[model samples]
Target: MSEAGDATVDRAHALDAVLLGGPRTLTLRDLAERSGLDLEQVRLYWRTLGLPHPDADEVAFTCRDGEALERLARLLHEDHLGSRTMISLTRALGHTSDRLALWQVEALVEDMATRRDLDDPAARRAVLDELADLAPVLETQLLHAYRRHLAAIASRYSVEFAAGQDVGGDPAALPLARAVGFADMVSFTRRTAGLGSTDLSDFVQRFETAARDVVTQCGGRVVKTIGDAVLFVADDVRTGAKVALELARVLGGDLDVERERGAGGLAEGARGVTPVRVGVVWGRVLSRFGDVFGPSVNVAARLTDIADPSTVLTDPATARLLVDTPGLLLEPLPARELEGIGTLAPVRVRTA
Candidate 1:
């Protein structure tokens, strides 16, 4: 191998050691034997972790892997966890970690390339070099974040449980009575058409960060961010309205000056801040696989599609709930024909 290739392999091994807490010493077969699990069982668990199963003879397993397998085996032996549940748990961890790792590495690469003026390959190399030092910190932070989120979920569930709310249901069943909303950037394609990669990334990141802040501060949670849009949810209509109105006010105001400038035939500003339109609905929704669904979600998305830039729109049901809300003004629009939902009145929401 070339000296560069050898150096890269050595660095990878070093990183593996740091992350796995030791060198890779066990073959797949050895790991199975050490953990008192059969090869097939090992493969099943490994594959569920979103990792490729190595050949039985391949010395790719570390002590950490063996320990994990042993713990899993113990749980199974004691009937503490069913095989299907274990598989599901591992799959969830694997899927989430895969995306989280990729996002962090890419963010690091972007920062390195932009701040250090390095090319992509050089930035990746820098990331690899820094991983040994950063891995432990990253791991700790991941655990901390996961624990906090888990605790919050537990607290929320506990409250409902104490209130005699029905918390038992099929894992894949849809949620009921959720406030679903969508906020989409107006003229996103046009605004970003001329931006370079770095500028575009910055713009999108800025929007997502700002939107998340607004949603969370308003007692709602962002479900996910699609390109040029964000989906959010709250337990009640009031919180959803607050989030939608706040996003429209803050994200839409950016375009106010631009609109005036454009009317006078002036050039756009360099900030690239795009205006957003929001739609919110209070209705039952199906929550599965970390995403929301159902008629409410669809209606919210469709409403967002037709809303004026920098404004919040809601169907009559949500509007009725928000009509008497303090500090909010709901201007009822005439019933209009929505493609799938037919004619329905949508209310424009603003801060009173």
Candidate 2:
């Protein structure tokens, strides 16, 4: 009997093998085979959670280490969270992790631990109950901290808005504070006017969808949508620039949907999609009511206007700050006479 029980233990250990390797980055096929899920089921989860399909070329999946797989599997299976909600929750939780505020981290860690299969039944229940009780308190504390930090930083930079008015604030600003920039669709004046309502809606939806994915992946926040454009803020310049460049690059490369709509799935005669231009500048700003503002904010808007339809442009200050950033290629542009700002030397950013 003891030998039989030992064999069962070995089986449990083998099942834990998935947790051994960090960020397996497995494909849909791999996930399906390992998790006993079908491809369609996995696809549903991805769609529900608004996750991009894993690319064969890119590091498709990852975790801190294989040990995380145990928790991840429980979250996926026992929690019964569909893929879409799971994805959104993952992003939210992941963002929270980036912050160093002790209470927030502790709260998250405590909540996460409740999902584990603990040996002590009484202790497990107490852990979960305590987390549930403390969650709201932790959330409130996090918000207060974020707001105070944002106010302090914005004050430090003496931020000013272009509209000569108050821009809204972001509730999640402190602890894991960041500078975020968003570049958006130009206007209703563009090609959108000629299309039907459904077509126009589809175009706008796709743009927003793609933009959000890029921002989340780059560890930035989308404060809110300003009609045609998105307002994004990142924790720092490198992250902000990467988000902008990625938005431009991904949007530029993905024209299949447009081609399908324009030419009824015919590739040869389909009109190409004109991707949105991106501009990013990083500096501390005032975040209020889910909005961001300041002088660095104004310069970012102006720089966006100067960018080509599918390129990212940044101010000299932002560029200089990123001189040491790895995997970034920065090129000096001819001293362009920027309106109101005068003879600006902006640097174009691309992946190195």
> What's the CA error at residue 233 for candidate 1, in Å?
1.1
- Give the alpha carbon lDDT tens digit for every residue of 179-266 in model 1: 8999999988887888888878867876787788788889999999998999999988999999898888767546435544542211
Instruction: List pairs with backbone clashes in candidate 1.
Output: none
lDDT of each: 0.83, 0.62
Query: Residue 217, candidate 1: how far off, in angstroms?
Result: 1.1
TM-score of 2: 0.46
Instruction: Please give each candidate's TM-score.
Output: 0.86, 0.46
- Per-residue lDDT over 228-289 for candidate 2, one digit per residue giving the tens place of the 0 to 100 score: 78878876678898888877766663455565655332222222334667878866577543
- 10 residues in a row with least lDDT, candidate 1: 263-272
